[model samples]
Target: MNEKLTKEEIMAALNERHSPEKQALLSEGRVAIAGLGGLGSNVAYALARIGVGHLHLIDFDVVDITNLNRQQYFMEHLGMYKTDALKSLLLKINPYLDIQTDCVKVTEENIVDLLGDEPIICEAFDRPEAKAMLVNGVLEHFPEKKLVSATGMAGYGSSNTIRTKRLMKNFYLCGDGVTEPEYGNGLMAPRVAICAAHEANMITRLILGEEEI
Candidate 1:
């Protein structure tokens, strides 16, 4: 007779594909994401699947029809706050993950508080201004924390241009590093997810004390 799988067994099976050392590192790492749109949603999902134990998701926006294109959300999540909806999805991926959501806008005055003391920060905002604000705020106020941000993930083709660069001590930027959203190029799933993957991978590397790519 086949044995029934317990919750622990299921979790072990889910994580059996990863090396024990990497899995242990991920389970002890905590990261805070500054946005919950295309980049943030995908970053959180990737980290959760990889067994990141704690995630702090900050977003004040609600799910809209337009976000269905590339966001890690479903139509059923429409009208729901991004943080709440994202938390629901992430938990389903790893039920043991500690996901904390803040449904509030991140501003210069409150960015530090919103992000908390998480050692890693993921800047996944769609707007240039918001991204800059978070990066600047972290660099100036929380220099001890490592930050990963992205730029120019818009448009299609030339996906190879999307690269992760170590900007400064404890700081990294991903994407083509030039394609601003206003270039009349539309944002699609392929490139956006590519950039998010870069950010997520960098975070994983940082957690494992691996050299920057």
Candidate 2:
């Protein structure tokens, strides 16, 4: 039999694992994800499990069998919009999570409206052009917002090379930043998740008032 967990009960359990002060910071954290593929999916999962109070999920893609190799979705989610599928999965983990999803492609015109209020933004687009678009859009429009982006996680490369780099005062990049799927063994679960973890950890640190990147 499955039992429904009350919000208080969930918080109580989280409190036992995380210090009250840490949980409070996480609960007050609000972030936006610009792609619901590999990096976004993993980052969302991490944030939800750690008690992020609010999340804005943005993606115009859908779950596909090809995504299973590195994404958070399962076979059951194939063909569902990424935002919808990820939101459903996340709610199962933290029922009280404030998840606002948009099933539309992120463009410069809509970027501000979609992520205006989120202090932290994660860029998880697949293509270099798409990643540039989001990063440029955010940097140009929301200069003060913290942005975490990834590159070069593709392939069965050395995990040690996957690192978090503080590019700007508020921008961080994770991964080897050199490996490309077109030239390597291609995207694998372990490396992708490793980079995603770096992004998630950076976001959490930012939420907890860590200034040293």
Instruction: Pick the TM-score winner.
Output: 2
TM-scores for every candidate against the unseen true structure: 0.94, 0.98
Off by over 4 Å in 1: 1-7, 182-184
TM-score, candidate 2, is: 0.98
Which residue runs does candidate 2 get wrong by more than 4 Å? none
Return the clash pairs for model 2, or none. none
* The 10-residue segment with the lowest total lDDT in model 1: 1-10
Q: Write the per-residue lDDT of candidate 1 for residues 13-113, one digit (tens) a residue.
A: 65687767767888889999989999999999999988888899999999999999999999999999999999988877666788988899999989867
Best by lDDT: 2
Residue 55 of model 2 has an lDDT of: 97
Candidate 1's clash total is: 0
What lDDT does the true structure give each of the candidates?
0.89, 0.93
The alpha-carbon lDDT assigned to residue 87 of candidate 2 equals: 97
